[model samples]
Target: MAGRRRSGGWRALLCLPLAGAFSLTALSGCGPVPAPDDPEGRDGRAVQRMLDQRAAAVRERDADAFLATVDRGSAGYLAEQRRVFRQMSAVPLRSWTYRLVRTGGFEPARVGGRSLAAQVELRYRLKGYDTAPVVSAQYLTLARRGGQWYVASDDGVVDGKRGTEQLWDQGTVDVVRGAHSLVLGVGQDRRVLRAVADTADRAVPVLGHVWPQEWAGRVVVEVPASLGRMAALLGASADGYRGIAAVTTGEVGGAGDETPADRVIVNPEAYQVLGDFGRRVVITHETAHVATRTATSASTPLWLSEGFADWVGYRTPGRTPRQIAPSSPTPSPPGTCPPRSRATPTSASAATPTASPAPMNRAGSPAA
Candidate 1:
């Protein structure tokens, strides 16, 4: 049987309206980001400036500038911050920005100076590889020192929530660049990353033939050491992506820098279980997302995006819809199109409309 898809996380978010999924990306486009309700109130604007400086430092690769944003008082976090900065040396970054979502998310105990907690949204794009930024949440606690607010720590707890775990947070990042793909992995062997790159490279050209549009024509694949870490990279619970082969992450209607490019993240266990043919289908399926992202938007509807990708994937290796019908089980559900049969003409009487459309998980394989 073919793999299944999902009805959660990336699939759902990617298709949401511009004001919904891509709302936080206000600063990404030509428009100005909405100022905080009280920009000049209680050091809110100060914190925003600090975040701006931090983003610039990352893009410029200036360690000193990056460290200036940290509060020296938090020794452990400071050291980890340094380590994370150094770890990013090999990964080429095209852009990085921080948007302060809100403040007072958590009230931290004061020690050296006055402190306040805030939730900040972090956005970054890999150079030459990402058109849109991989968006993540950062729970931060800032301290006032010498009348200036500094990032005290990122381990802030608001309703037991902390900053989202990034790939660098897990371990050292290893990069493998292909003609049409860039593979980033944590704690993965070179050969494994190579295989991912090779698979993605093969899929890109094939995808172009079907999806004739002006797209990146490339993909970025992230392979973490385990399934759990894969979930972490996506800031999702493992349950949402578990048992799935792979998932594509991206945004729509992005003519310029307004959205992030498509990413093909593999589920180690599930993806590895697939045979060669299955892997090709999965990779090609996700590559199609990269190719068709800007061509369609939230207005296109979920079924069109998913069903089209699935069709393109299954279409590759020269398989016809007739050949695929047998492997796909159609449960008896009310009001479904009747199956074609030699004994009877196409009629509702013989139709087994037992199931709803495949839950729109937008997965490359069987959903969890």
Candidate 2:
């Protein structure tokens, strides 16, 4: 049997607290003294400023500037920070940003006579390889030394201790670049990788023609070696995603903002079972999600979203309604279309339906 195409919705996942994930030693240094209001309040502002400075440094790609915000007193922490910067520098980045997702007001602890420690949630994205930026979250430790704040430590695990591998950390990756698309794969068969690249190349132009003009035409596809690795990328468990063909994920920007980075991740096991035509159809459908993600919302009907994707994927192909419907063991009723089908005219001049359509339930089934 052919594997089913799955459409996974995008949403933020909160997995664990920051302190439980990693350990860091308190950092201390010397700086100018502050006025005597609430010392904790002043330290909070300083920590915020430190985070802002660190974010700017990443965007600027300045190694020295980025390190200035780290605790200089901790040699081991400084070395780790330097290594991270070096790795980031080697990658081609379109943009990088970090925002503090506060769990609560900063809880300051007096570590020593002059040193302090606090915790905050950090949300960050490093957009590279022309795909949607992989959004990552971590709980971080900040310290006050001298009179300025510095990042003391962070839980570098992308998702949690269980998900220690980031995209870069996944063994060796081979990148296939096209005019408007980038395909990355790890431990994948070279033949399959090339096939995915070819499919994406063809799908991009079709998507450009079919989707709204406002969306950026670029697309990124990731083919992980195994379902376990793909789940790590998604910050989920393998069991939760079994039998899914592909899923599109990324942050949705607010109105007037461009769509945030989006990625189409393929299920290696499920995708491998598909024939050539099925492969293209699945790729085009997921690419449609990448193209239309910015304009889509929770309120958008699933039929419209999935139907439009199917429409684009099946367009110009000589496939019939029966061929396009989801495979089932039992036969479908004659002349009764699939619940999700939106009939398209056989030709431009074909007659249109004049009657009002029946209401559809949340599952896309016609209301009785």
Candidate 3:
């Protein structure tokens, strides 16, 4: 992965961008075509080789060399590029698919030596997920550098537009342990959700042994489609936080119009980015927040809250970050929150158990 370098002082994973084909554009100044001796299939083969190299770098979470190959310009562009890589690092291989949709702009005398542009479609299959596949049309630019062709840019990449209601209508949740209620829905694919529900159903005194006792009655477990729509509309915020899973509402302690807990929302599109145990791990991480008595607090630190969530989410079995991101001394503000004086916790409130929360769990609700 990202070597040992972490971003600023935070230990949270630094998400990077994945290179899409539709985003890159080849400008004017047409170079002469290759010699007639060039094999007809060579161009595609060359592109494949370049893709393999880039993929290897991605697998390693090497942002520096990855952007270097793409001719990224300006700090903002480079920053966004790195973000794509970080996101890609989390996606499972089986869920991601790249297909060549078109090919042209073949020319010579390009930076790095030769240049070619191709149109490709990237379809991220959502596995065990009820949401629509996040599809992107990519424009890929390639250049030969030091005798080796490299991916230069990806232009016009668009995440698939879909509604969240569609996702929830597709799956079912076996249990809904909330402060208000438990919800029962219908669907198939009853594996993990069922297992978790079964564990809860038996009341076998397992939660404390499996998870922290504090999580008892505090944890809210939802199925894949639980909040699909809310997630889609809020995945990417207007602020710099690209690909935001959800925003936390309110503060850690109830003070100055403060609430007891914060609200958490997620984007279904983000689920498609996960590979391996990504889906379960992310959900668990978010759920851990719900389990906490306090909203995220300064005393907890970014690394502990985020990293510990990740640690617990992956606690299921056989899941870990691909590469540890470089640590940063500076901490990123949580979502669009403004700075304020920290408030002290009055006391731990008793958690109430009830049926499904009507506001949080809207039956057959669509993404707004």
Candidate 4:
């Protein structure tokens, strides 16, 4: 089943109508505040200046300048930056309340020699529809260079904890077990979980190679409630593990009881497919993988895992499988999986392959 891809964090925001039009050329900096120009202090100022400038560019929807300031070398840094912008792009800024906070420590950044690393906290107010006025404490690293400051990173910290995922839409949600009711605020979370779980159950069969039925009795399944939530979960997961891992929603830590044979964690984002009613189809595709034990390792190729998932997902009722596009290279020989039977959608909404989609938790584990 094809699903509409959520915008990739910063990279996607860069392409937005508003963000892509403005041009920000004037750089931000403060004149000499003290004698000798404190490199550490200067770096801090530089980073802050960059942060403010980037914010303005984002507000102004200035594409060129935003990209120029950020260093794409660090994957985590890039992803984090993108995630914030993606939300900003979706939710227009109504107003902002900025207050000085604190910097716990200072160091130097390896990316650019001139930048200093200091953790600074910012208290601000964000207003959006459906969401209450959000009072947040954001954490950021400031770097000093030459005589200016640049933001090394913004961790999206709020009230000392990182911000939750910013979900954009929750439409036509369905739940399998509980009588899930959708409320606007806190109650909405519970529904998100229930609906996501139901989606995962529907997905189990579609991810065949990774989710063979042999382990069905033992494996535990998990799902993230919203798309925004998946970002934080992905961040936590990315702290460890590498390569293609899926980051779905829900809490961290392990099920602790299941063995490799019995546990399979599902990506709640897979539920995004549900938006088009193709969710059950897509989840089955992913679940099939979990059941099959298909994970990171050169042994299992991307095309193979993806193609297999698609194959399993196509089996759902009402689906008409079609052959893989001639444009794509088959992971296995053409005959390995059953011939595609589902009629492909007029416009495919599949998530494009970027760096691996999944992130493993700190324990060096996927969200099983």
Per-candidate clash tally? 17, 5, 53, 50
Query: What is the per-residue lDDT of model 1 for residues 23-54, given as tens digits with 9 covering 90 to 100?
Result: 54454342232333334543678889999999
If both were scored by lDDT, which would come out higher, candidate 2 or candidate 4?
Answer: 2
lDDT of 3 at 42: 52
Q: Residue by residue across 23-112, what tens digits does model 3's lDDT show?
A: 321232122333322323456666655555555565555777677656432345456566666544533333444555545533222344
Rate residue 44 of model 2 by lDDT.
55
- Model 2: lDDT equals 0.59
- Full-model lDDT, candidate 1: 0.72
The lDDT leader among the candidates is 1
Give the least accurate 10-residue stretch of model 4, judged by summed lDDT.
Answer: 178-187
Please, what are the lDDT tens digits per residue for candidate 2 over residues 178-257?
66677778788778878898888888899878775566677788888888887777767787667566777754434333
- Residue 59 miss distance in model 4 (angstroms): 2.5
Rate residue 184 of model 3 by lDDT.
28
lDDT score for candidate 4 against the true structure: 0.39
> lDDT of each structure?
0.72, 0.59, 0.39, 0.39
Give the winner by TM-score.
1
